[model samples]
Structure formats: structure tokens, C-alpha cells
Target: MDQKIIKVITGQRRVGKSYLLFQLIRLIQEREPAANIIYINKEDLEFSFIKTAEDLNKYVLANKVEGTKTYVFIDEIQDIENFGTALRSLLLKEDLDLYCTGSNANLLSGDIAGHLSGRYVEIEVYSLAYPEFLAFHKLAENNKSLDKYLKYGGLPYLIHLELEDEVVFEYLKNIYSSIVYRDIINRYSVRNTTFLEQLVLFLAAHTGSIFSAKKISDFLKSQRVNMAPNQVQTYIQHLVNAFLIHKVARYDLVGKRLFEIGEKYYFENLGIRNGLWGYRLEDRGKIMENVVYNHLLFKGYKVQVGILGNKEVDFIAEKDGEKLYVQVALTINNPDTLEREFGNLKNIPDNYPKKVVTMETFSGNTVEGIEAQDLRSFLLA
Candidate 1:
């Protein structure tokens, strides 16, 4: 809601940043009919001439109407060389509101930080949440919709494609290739392409499990693939920087400390993970955990994998001093499974709400003072 600061939207490619920009533009136009708005999409071939700070400044000045505040929206501003210089030059103007979007984290890296000097605010955009996905596709809120969401995942464009297996698979495959080839490989000039592919597959296969770079390297060694732990670490960093995957650290509840080792990785989108692993249903438990992780993030919580003594809690979500201890599972039909999920939260002494989320229909039941809710209602809520 702070309109004064430069709004910089950053996220992975095709995660709906561009669409969000268009929505903002529509809102602004509806609010103020006579507003001066200059929209520039660097990816468009028509604006190919504006590739530098000076070109950007000249183009805006010439098109901007006088005696009115101008709103500038630039898509993929990082494509311009020294974009910070252009932004800084424009910031000196008294009546301009600037917004831009970028797919790479380097848009706000140290170099840009020095140039902008804390003048911009960033809004990180993500793919569609469950409610948004349901509303977008006009699907009913039922078990069938949830199953489709679990298999196809929530890439915005997927709603437009035919829901056939081959079509969805091919679309997801292309998205994965583009993210790797353009965002990671070409941008960073990564030489070990094969290793990068294998690393991504390994991470996708083990979405909710905890593992370190050394462990990954050792696993690869068994397959006759030679990779140093340091190299593996660097490659993983590249993936993180590209916003292709997220790494969550372990928080020890008893010790009140964070462990550097044994961190978990989750994909930015489930469709990408499914595409990488051929949509195999053999690991639904881990896949469901990944879904819960993303949902907690969508709800604006700072999430971490919780470690209470030696047992693992799926997620420790905290926001504005309100905390929720969550456990995710595919089902709690078996008594042993229910104990394992609810028992982990009981170990924690805090009175904050504890929850167990599963795919089972809600029986309106509580296990050992912890509420167990169905995943469908949780997602919509």
C-alpha cells in the first residue's frame, strides 16, 4: 500500500509477476482516468532500442505528459544495462511513481543495492494459491479438485491447457527447460549442465526430506558421477538464487537454536517437481508435505522445519507473534500414523495452536488436545 517507494516485484519466471503488473495498471486506470502511465516491456521487440539508462530516461521524458504525476511500469528492468542508474535518474523527478518486475534475484543484489541505496521496496510474488487456483479454473471445492491440483500442480497457465496427461507433462517440461536454460545456465554460464540436471532431479525426487550437499555428492558418487561437495553446494545456491527451489533450515525447539546441517528443500511449484519426476504417485506423503509448506508460505508465515527433541514437526509457522505448529500427512486413518503426527506437536510446551492436516475428510476430532483438519478446508481457509 506504500505507493511512494519504488515497488520492485521479484520471483521466478511465469509465476504471474507480469500479470500482477497488468492488474495494478488496471486498478490505477480505474481509479484515475487521466493518470499519466508509461508502460515498457523490455521483452517486447518494439522497445529493443531502449537498452540503457539514457535511452530509458529519454523515452520516458518524451512520452510523459506534463503537469500530471507519471506512473512508470517496466517489466524485466534487469534486461537494461545499469537499470539502477535509470531508476535513480527518474527518482529525482518530483511526481513519478515507479514499479518494475524481474525474474532473477540479482536485480536486487549488492551492486543494485549500492546504486538504489534503500530507495525501493520489494514484493515477492508466487504462483497461485489453492483458493486462487480454484477461482481461476472455476472448479468446485471437492475431493476431485484437490486430486487434480495435487497431480497437475498450480502453474497459472496450466488452467488453459487441456488436462490430458501428455499435454500437461509437455508444458511442464518446457517450463523446466526454460527456467534452467535461460534463468540458470545462460545467466550464470553454468558449465556442468549434466550435474545441474541430476542435482535438480535429485532435489525434486526428495522434496520434503532433509539432506546436505555432501550427502548428495556421496549419493552421486555411488552412481559413478564425480562431483565435489563444494561444487554441489555452489550449484544448489544457483538454483536458490533463481527461485527454482527453497531451502528451509531446522529449528530446535528444546535448544532454541537453528542447525546448519540437515536442511530441507521444496520446489517453487509442484508442477515443476511432477514434471521432473514423471508425476509418480509413489511418494504422496512427501509431496503432500511440500504442498503444505507452500500453503503456509502463501499465508505469509515465516516457516521452518521444527525439531522437538529428536522427532520432526512438519512446519513451525510464525507471523506477527502468532505461531502455529503444523504436521502434514496424506492420511491419519491408522492409529500409529495419528500418534506419530499428533505426538510430535504434544512434545512442544507452547500453548499456541497445534494442528494436524491430512487428506482425510474432517471427522471434527481432536487427538490429544491437537486439532486435526482436512487439507481441503485448510487450503480454502
Candidate 2:
């Protein structure tokens, strides 16, 4: 609760970053009832005057109590100009426990990292994981719940909305617009809004598919949107920085190196993807793959696409110096489907927990030592 380093809680816009800050504030209040807490939310119009570093410092210092640890909480700190300078100054005070939330990942990767360096630790918040989704919706763990999860995705705010396509998708679409307009376009000063939206749509449509910037650019060109490969790359990076989508590099199983040319893009929230790009039965395989990737990430794994010669493994998740190979499929009902999903993981020589996840339920069966788990079981576990 009381740390000298700045706790930077970052995520996409409206992913409950502010709610998390409130939770932290609640925890602190419970722990220290008489603590001095200074809270500033830039999104709130009341804090509009606190725009610059001087404004921030003056407000915090003015509210500071003598000989006591002040827990400072700032929401959307990126709204403040030269926020790193204010944070750097505030961090020096032994009694001030600095904590701030940001919606942009670039806030850490760019100048802030240069200013704060080792003085700050980033906590990346994501959309509700599968378990959290079930709990939030007050739904029992079942196929129907899973379907709702896959269809709507795990945006925490979805709890208040009715789980209807018209209701949920509309809300999700609005959230998507906010993220694109405010986080991506406004933050990066993106010029070609049309190209950016098209790119996002393309990524959503082709989620879990591996391709390069040149490939994307050429494809867009075919669609009459002529953007250079470099520009396409820049817009994609902007999306990634905004935490709208994650770019998973293709890892070579044999060479033990990552491939630079091709990478898979998965949306941070599936509802946003489904809202923007209509949810279809035909795209279930890719949707399942995206769900698996998000779950792996939710469980704190560093995931990548694995390339084993001619075959492809959906995910290579690693955490705590340990590795786990995962292959996602809609169903392994067919012999060929089963072989491809299991065979790819079996090809991995290292015996570090290889498994296949699918929508179909199995009786704890293992295909040549590779486990098969239903999507719900995998997500919950």
C-alpha cells in the first residue's frame, strides 16, 4: 500500500482502470483509516485546472500533511502535461506514496520511462478474464455462459447492460470508438482516420492469422486504400500501444528464435472485435484462438505464435522460466483436426505441458501424452 516507487496502472480506455484505482484507495482506507489521501481524476471536469506539472505539484503539495505518508492517486495521468516531471518530483518526497493510472502503454515506453527509469513499476490491466466475466455477469459456468463471453467479450462495464446483441454490441462499439478516437487518433495525431479504422477492421477480421506490414499494406491497396508499409506499421503500433490489440510474434520452435516477418494480432476485448466486425459462426475457430490467447495472457503468461516447420502451434505460453505449448481449435472431432492440433504440440521435443483446447468436451483424454481440454475448463483452470 505504501511504496516509494510509482505504481503505474495502465490499460486501454474504459477497461476499469479507474475502478481499479478506487479499489486500491478502498484497500488503503481500510488499512490506514487516518491516512492522508490526495485524489485527482483528470477525466473529471473539476480537475481541469490541473493541466501542467506545476498545477499538479502545487495541488498535491498544498494538500500534503506533515510527518505523514500521503497516498496520491491520479487517474489518467497522461492528461497532465509533463506528468513525468511532476511524478519525479513527487516521488522524491519520502512521505508521499505515488500511484497513477494511464490508458496508454506509450506513457511507460516513451519519455516517462526516460524520466522515471527504475523508479516506477507498471501494472498492465486488461479486460475481465473469463472467470471474472462469469462472476461479473452472475452467470453459472456453462456453455451458454461461455457463448455469451465469447460473443460479448469481457469488458467489465458490460455487467450493467443487458446481454443482447443490440444492447451489448452498441455499448461495445461506442467503447471501441472512444479507444480509437481518443487513445489512438488523438494520442498519436493520426492523420488518416479512414486507414486506421480499416486497419482495425482488417485485424479483427483476420484475428489469429499471421501476416506482415507489407502483406497488410498490399491487401489494403487491393481494397483501394493505398498506405505505405511503414505507415501501416506505424498505425498498427499505435493500436498496440493503446492496448486495443496485441501483436504476438511467430516463434520458431526448431531455431529457438522469433520470426520478424509474420505476427498474429488478437484484440484486447472480443466484444469490441465482434461489435466492430459482426460475430459469425464461420469465424468460430479464429474467435476460439483469440479467446485462448487472452486467457493465456490473463493468467500472466508471455505468449507467442509457435512455428514448427510446416505446422503451426497456436500459442507458446511461458511464465516463471517455465514453458507451455497450447494449440487452439474449434473441435478435434475429425481425425485430421485432432492430429494437427496434437501433432504440432507433440512435435515440440521439450515435454513442458502441451495441450489442445477446443469447444468440444472430452473425458480427460490425452492424445499421445498431449492433453485435451474443453475451452471452459481451460479458461477456468
Candidate 3:
């Protein structure tokens, strides 16, 4: 927040974007009361005074809110048409630092990017990581805590035990619907809402499996979920925009040719996936992978599902341009399974770090050119 000249926080809805904004603004105001601050939330229906760029401009001019320094806080800025223009206008006129929040990247893609080029920074705010999740729940770091996080997920509000399932999931669903309806459909004028929902649900159910657009399209066609290759891509993009799913392309480090065929899509919140799947025992491995990928992302690693020949790695992460390969399994229980997991990383070329993350609940160790750490240890560390 300090380094960003004009900060924009983007993530899935109810992932604490607005709350983080409120906290930052309160901190800024407490530290510098002399700084003129105007907080406007477009989602607030009471504020009918702000629906467009002209409305915002008229109000700002009428208020005579002149100052040497100004901090404009806009929440759900996508609701305002031409927000980029309005913000750019304000930034040009004064020593202003603009902070805005949105649930998706579309808010900053076309006009917003063009209008605010070289003048803005974007930060991603995801759901609570395991450590934060544990903090919120007053739970100690242990295997029991990891198991709970895997099941319930780390939505901050859900950390309060009293918050009923009916309430928390409802809130999360509304935010998801808003991103789909307002951000994706309304913004893009999409007509196939049914297909989009099916696509999201489909991806949620199959999070960690290697899939391709053609495979999905063919499956949909067989199930009467008919759509073209291009349409599948479009729906996938829309899901990505809503931060509901992320696609990890297969990158062969040895071959260096980015494969277009098979990839994996991860849901941003494991709890959301649980809600979609009704939390089954069969889904535990996926839930583990989901948690591991998110922890890496929260720690500032650009992560993706890794592909090495016929062997597969769960995640390939990069931090400060250095890479780490990871695999998450329920157990290396059988001798055959253990050998397969270790062998995949053993044959890889460079020593860029490798690990097998699991729910075994033991301390970390280096075994056969790769680190073996239990889920609890890996997360807490």
C-alpha cells in the first residue's frame, strides 16, 4: 500500500477487499488527518448522487473540497461508468492518490488501463491463508487445525464459530453471483449465463485434474452441455475474471514449449469448492492441492500446475524469479505411489528446489533430492 502510487486491490468478492480498504483508509486518516479524504462506495444505493463520471465530477466541484493533498477511496468502482476518466481527471488536477477496489481485472483492462497507464498499481487480496485462518479461529498449529481448514476453508467471517454455514455460504454465493452477473455478464453483455454457471461448477468439481477445452467441450456435448471450443474458452475466461477459477498451463521446462492441451483450474477458495461438491471424502486430495496452491499464491508466488513428460507435479511456483516444484498427495502410502512421486522430481534437470507436500502431519525432511513435509508443517512454515 505504501509503495503503490495509485493502489487498486482486486480479488474474489467477500475476500476482504472492502474491509482491507476501510482499514487502510482509517490508518491513513489517523496518521494524517490533514489529508483531505473522500470515501464513496458506488454499491451504496443511498448514494444515488454518484452513478456516473459527470455525477462524481459535479459533486466534487460543488463540495469545494480543495486541498494540497487528497485521498479518494472508491469501492466497487466498476459500477461507475467511465470511472477511469473520472479518476484520471482528479489525479491530473491535484496531488491526489486514488485507491479503488474491484472483484475482477476487467475493471482495469480496456479503458481503465489506457486511461491510467503508468499511473497505477494493482494488488491481489485473497482469502485468509492457513496461518491467518488459524489465528481467526483461535486454533493452534497442528494436524487437527489443518484438517479443519481443509474442510471449512479460510473465509475470515467463517472463522467465527457462531457464524452458521447457512449465513456464510449465502454471503459467499451472493458475492460470486454479483461477480458473474454484474462484472461478467452485464459488462460483457453475455447471453449464455447457463453455460457459464455449468462451466464454473464443472471446473469446481474437477479442480486438480488435467483438462483441456476440447475435453470439456466434448464432455459438455455428450452431456448435452453443448458449446464450441471458442465458447468454452470464453466461459473459462469469464470464470477467471470472477476469480472463481485459475487455469495452470503445462510448461515443460526441458522442452520449453508451453502446451495448450491439458491444464488444471483451481478454485480460489477450497470452502467454495466444498460447497459445490458437498464435501466428500473422495475430494480430499483436491482439497489439499487447493490449499497448497493458495498458500503459495498468498506468499507471493506465481503458481501453476507443473507438467514433466508423463509425470505430473502438483504446482510450479516462482518467487523473485526462482522456481519451486511441488506435489500434493493424500499419502505416499504404497511403495509404488511413493516411488512415482519422488521419481518425477528426481529426473528434473536443475536444482531449483523440489518438494512433496502432504497431510501426513510430520516435520519436514529432504528425501531423494526433494523435500517431504506434512501439510501442517508446510502451511505453518
- Give the candidate number with the greatest TM-score: 2
Ranking by lDDT: 2, 1, 3
Model 3 per-residue lDDT at 334:
76
How many collisions per candidate? Answer: 0, 0, 0
Worst ten-residue run, lDDT, model 3? 59-68
Candidate 2: tens digits of C-alpha lDDT, residues 1-381: 577799999998888989988998899989999989999999899999999999999999999999998999999998899999999998889999988998888799885898989988888888899899988988999989999999999888889989999999999899889888888888788889988999999998899888899999999989999999999999999999889999999989899998989899999999999999999999999899999999899899999988889889888899999999988888888999888788788778897999889888888658888899989999999
Each candidate's TM vs. the true structure?
Answer: 0.94, 0.98, 0.93
Locate the minimum summed-lDDT window of 10 residues in model 1. Answer: 109-118
**What TM-score does prediction 1 earn?**
0.94
Residue 354 shift from truth in candidate 2, angstroms: 0.3
Cα lDDT tens digits for candidate 3, 30-115: 99886677788877886666988888766655543555666778888777777787877766655566788987677778657888
Task: Assess each prediction's global lDDT (C-alpha) against the native.
Answer: 0.87, 0.91, 0.79
Clashing pairs in 1: none
Which has the higher lDDT value, candidate number 1 or candidate number 2? 2
Mind giving the per-residue lDDT tens digits that candidate 1 earns over 198-223?
A: 99999988888899989999999999
